[model samples]
Target: MFPKLDPILHSELRLAVMSILAGVESAEFSYIKKQTGATSGNLSVQIDKLSAAGYISVEKGFKGKVPCTTCKITPAGLAAFENYVNSLKEYLI
Candidate 1:
């Protein structure tokens, strides 16, 4: 039987966000939005979901007086991502 996938990471947008963060130490909201081609409102809502799940960390601050939000994957998140990938691989076997 295939392993169950994580519902939170199952989302395309959320998975994209996690994929981006998995490769980098951190990323700015604008960068994530640009990479994912997601609208601000949609991205914000998805981000809130990830944050609420403790899958990622969101930091709000300012860059030269302009509001800025950054995201980083937590340890649990990395493990979850790895497990998610492994589960996907199981489907192919």
Candidate 2:
């Protein structure tokens, strides 16, 4: 049987995360939280999961004296999101 969209990837927050990551060079953690309308704690947890899965990269640094964290989607992540939509298209047809 063909693979379906993974449950982990199909969640609203995760899908939104991947979609936004797909568009930009990189985004800050706070930026993602703002755009997704997710709480900071929730966004942090979801991003960590994506990072562990090798779907995205997380970088921690400082901007001036303040702390900063950024995220970018990996090639694997982009491919997975595309494939997930394709999987759903099969059901839609």
Model 2 clash pairs are none
* Top candidate (lDDT): 1
**In order, what lDDT does every prediction score?**
0.96, 0.90
RMSD of 2: 1.3
The lowest-lDDT stretch of 10 consecutive residues in candidate 1 is 1-10
User: Taking the tens digit of each residue's C-alpha lDDT, what string does model 2 give over 1-44?
Assistant: 56677776888998899989999999998889889999989998
lDDT for 28 (candidate 2) = 95
TM-score of each candidate structure, all chains considered together: 0.97, 0.92
Q: Please list the residue runs of candidate 2 whose C-alpha ends up more than 4 Å from where it truly belongs after superposition.
A: none
Off by over 4 Å in 1: none
C-alpha lDDT of residue 23 in model 2 = 96
- The best candidate in terms of TM-score: 1
